[model samples]
Target: MTETITGLHDVADRFDAFLIDQFGVLRDGAGPYPQAPAELKKLRALGKKIIILSNSGKRSVENSVRLAKLGFDEACWDWFLTSGETAWRMMAAETDGGARKRCLLISRDGDTSPLDGLDYNRTEDADTADIVLIAASEGDRYDLGHYQTLLQPAAERGLRCLCTNPDKVMLTADGKAFGAGRIADLYEELGGAVTWIGKPFPDIYDQAKIFLGAIPPRRICAIGDSVEHDIAGARMAGIASILVETGIHAEASPTERAALFALHEAAPDFILPDFRL
Candidate 1:
C-alpha cells in the first residue's frame, strides 16, 4: 500500500535529489501554486538537488522564463529539462543522409519554437508534408472532432508524427483539458504512426539521468500529479515516486483514484495533498 503524507517534509531526508513535474505538480496553466515556490526553496535549503522535469512541448529556456514570470526564483532548482528540448537535441544529432523533411506543426497558440533551430520546413498543407509534429494542445479553442478532420489528410498520407508532450490531460485555467498527447492518439487511431518523446518513455528518462549527474537511482525521487506519466515513469526509471493531489486529479473521488491506479498498474511510494514544506 502507498503511504500518504502531508508534504515533502515527511520524506525530505529519504532522497538527495528530486525530479519535479511542471504543469500539474508545480502550477496550473494560469499561475503558480501558492506554496510551491516556498516549498522548493525549503527543499533547496536542505541541500536537495532539484530538476524541473516536464513533458511540456516548449523548449527548456521558454519554460524557465515562464516559471520566472510566475514568481518562482531561479535559485530554487538546479536545472530544467523539457521533452521538447530533449527531442530537439535528438533531431539535431541525427545523422540520417536524407534531406530535410517538410513538417506540418500543430501547437497551442501557433507557437513554433520547437522547430526554431531545426532544419525542417514548415508547411500549412498536410498533403504536401512529410511529417507531423504535435507539440501543444489547443483544446480550449477546438474540439477533438476538429482535430480528427484536420489530421485525416496527413493520416492518409502516412506522415509520421512526433509527439513531444505525452500528457493526455493537462490542468488549464478552465480546469482539465485535452493535451497534445490526445491529438497524437487521434492520429494513431486514424492509422498514422506516432513516436512519443516524453514521459512514460525511456528517451526522456535517459536524458534526465545525465542531467541528474552521479545521484544513484535509489537517492532520487520523482514528484508529479499524473499516475500514468509521473508514477509509471518513475517506476520505469527505477526511482521512487510521490503523487500530489493538487493537480490533474485534484477532484477525483477515492473510488476514481483507485480505478486510475489499477488502470495504470502503478502506485506511488507516497501521496501528498500538495507540494509544501
Candidate 2:
C-alpha cells in the first residue's frame, strides 16, 4: 500500500537521515533542479543528515565537481558516494577471487578514471581478457542492441562481467540514455555472469551505513526514481523508500506505476511527485 504524497515535507519529521539519489531527484544531466539545493539546505538546517547516493559510474570527486558546476555546493550535503567509487575500491583491493588479472573494459567517451591507479591490466580484445568491466554506456546514440556484438562473444567465452553502475537508464534534461546495466543485462541473457555492484545489490547500502552512523533502518529513507534500483535496494537494505514519479517513470500513469511496483515487488512506503522538500 504505497501512499501518493505531495512532497518530502509530509514525512521529513519521521526520519533523521536521508539517502538521496542524484540522477532524477537532484538534477538531470543538464543542471541542478531549481529547488533541490535549497530544499536540501532546509533539511540540513532541521538537523537532518543527508548523503548523496548515486549509481553513477563516475568517481566521487568527479560527481562532486559536476554537482558544483550545477550550482550545488558541497555545503548542501554532508557527503556523497557513487557506485564507481565503491567498485574502484573493491577492484583495488582485489576482492574478486574469481576474476583474472586482466580485464576487457567497456566505457563511454574515453573515461577510464575508475581504472586509474589500479594494478589490473586492460585489454581491447575480449578473447584475451580474463573478465569484462562495464563502467558506462556510449550515451544516447547507443542502446542495448548496439552492444550485442560486443557482449555475445564475451558471453560465449564465459567471462564474468562486473557492472559498476546498476542503473539501466539515466534521465537527464536532454533525454534518457542507456547505462551500463543495460549492457550487463544483455550479457546475462547471453549466459554471461554479471556482478552488479551498485544499488539493489545491498553492498553500496552497507557502505553508506558508515556515513549514516548507527541510525536504525526505520529512521532512514531512500529517495530515488528507479523502482528496480532505488526502491528495491532500500527494501533489501531494511530501510524505507520514497519513489519519485518525475524521474525515470515520468510518463507512467498511476496504473503503470502500480504495475511496476508489483512487478518489482518493491513498493515504496511513499510515492512523491518530485523531490520537493
Candidate 3:
C-alpha cells in the first residue's frame, strides 16, 4: 500500500538526504515551479543533504545556469548531477584513441554542447557514424514519426544509440511532449542497439552512490513526478521514493496510479501532490 501525503514535510525527518528530479519536480519547460526553490531551501535549512539528480542530458554547469536564471539559489542543494554530464564524461573517456569519433546526434534546435569538449565528430548522415546520441527534441512541434527516416537506416546498420534523456514524455507548462526516450524506443524497434541513460537505469544510480558516500540507501529519499522514471529508478537503486502528482501523472486517477505501480512492479514509499516542503 502506498501512503499519500501533502508534501515533503510530512516525512522530512525520516531521511538524511534527498535525491530530487529536476524536470517536473523542480520546473517545467518554461520556468521553475513557483514554490520549488523555497521548499528546497527549507529542506536545506533543516541540514538535510540534497542532490539534484536530473535525467536531463544537459551538462551540469548548463543546468546550474538554467536553474539560477529561473530564480533557484545554489545554496539549496549540496551538489548537482545530470545524465548529460555523465554521458559527456563517459564519451570523453572512450579509449578509441582516434583522431575523432563520428556520431549522429539528435538534439534540440541543433544544440551540440553536450558533445562539446569530446573527441567526437558530429555528422548529419547516420550511416557513416559510429554511434547515435540523443540529447533533446522539439517534441511539442514534432512527432516520433518525423524521425523515422533518419533512425530507420541507422537501425538497419545496427548502430548503437546512447540516449541521455530516458523519459518518454516530459511535462511542460504548456502540456506533455515527447522526449529523447521516445526516439530511443523508435530506434530499438527499428533494430538498433540502444543504451538508455539516466533514470530507471542502474548506471546513473551507481554514479550517484559515488557522491552519497556512506549513507545507506534507506536513509536517502528520491523525489520526482514521474513514476516510470523516478519511482522505478529509485527502486532499482534500492532507495525509497516519493512520487509527486504534479508532473506527467498529474491527471492520473487513483486507479490509474495503482495500475502504474502494479505495472512497473515498483511503488514509491509515499506520494505527494507536489514537492512543497
Candidate 4:
C-alpha cells in the first residue's frame, strides 16, 4: 500500500537517490532558495546519488553553468538533467528536412538556453524560421496574439512546433501560478501537435535514470512541484515521488495542501515544504 509523505527527513531516509525539480523548490526564477543547496549537500554527505531533474529548456552547458552559480556543484547533486537538452536533441533528430537548422523560438525573452548547434530566429523574424518552438517567455507581452502571428501560420504551412517545458504554470514563493506549459496546452487546443520533451514521458526519465548508472526504479525518488509530470511519470516508471511545496501549486496552508492531495488523489511518499532536512 502507498501513503502520504509528511516530512523531508522521513522521505529522504527511504531512498538511496533523489531526482529533484529545480525552478520551484530549489530556486525561483530569480535566485536560489537558501535552504535548498544546504539540503542537497546534506543528502550528498549521506551517500545519495542526486540528480536535478529539471524541465529547463536550455543546453547542458547553460544548465550546468546556471546550477553552479546557484551553488549546485560538487558539494550537492552528482548530475543534472534538463528538458531543454532532451527537447533540442529530439527536435534536431525528428526533422530531417524543412530548413535543416532554423527554428523560431518562443521562450523566456532573455533566454539563450538552447544547445550550441540549434539555430533560432525571433518572432519578429518569423518570415525566416523553419520550425516554431514555444516555451515560456519572460513577460505577458508575448501572448496569444504573439503566438498566432508567429506560430499559427507556420503550423498551417506544415512546420513543426516544439514545446520545451510541458508545465503550464508554476507556483511562486509568494504563491502565484505562472508558467509556459499553458502555451503548449493552448497550441494543442488549436489542433497543433507538439512533442513534449519533459517528464511524464519515459524517454527523458529513462535517459536520466541511465545517467545514475543503471539504478533500479524502486531505489529512486522522483521529486518535483507538479503532479501531472513528476507523479504521473514516477507511476509509469514504478518509482516513488516527493512533492516539494515551493513551486507551482505551492501550499499556502496545511488545509490547502490536504485539498491538493485530495484533488490529485495521488500522494507523494514525502512532502517537502522546502529542501530542508
Task: State the lDDT of candidate 2 residue by residue for 96-195, as single tens digits.
Answer: 5554477788887778787887767788777788788988887576766768877788899999888999888877457888788988888899999999
lDDT of 1 by residue, 124-236 (tens): 78989988989899898899999998899999989889999999997788878899999999999999999999898989888878878898999999999999999999999
Cα-based lDDT at residue 260, candidate 4: 61
Spell out the clash pairs found in candidate 2.
Answer: none
User: What are the TM-scores, per candidate, against the unseen true structure?
Assistant: 0.97, 0.93, 0.96, 0.84
Q: Model 3: residues >4 Å from true position, as ranges?
A: none
CA lDDT of each prediction against the hidden true structure: 0.89, 0.85, 0.87, 0.69
Better of 1 and 4 by lDDT: 1
Q: What TM-score does candidate 1 get on C-alpha atoms? A: 0.97
Residue 2 Cα positional deviation in candidate 4, in Å, after optimal superposition: 6.3
Candidate 4 segments exceeding 4 Å error: 1-7, 92-99, 110-115, 119-128, 171-177, 252-265
Error of 4 at 195 (Å): 0.9
- Model 4 TM: 0.84
Q: Cα lDDT of model 1 overall? A: 0.89
The better candidate by lDDT, 1 or 3, is: 1
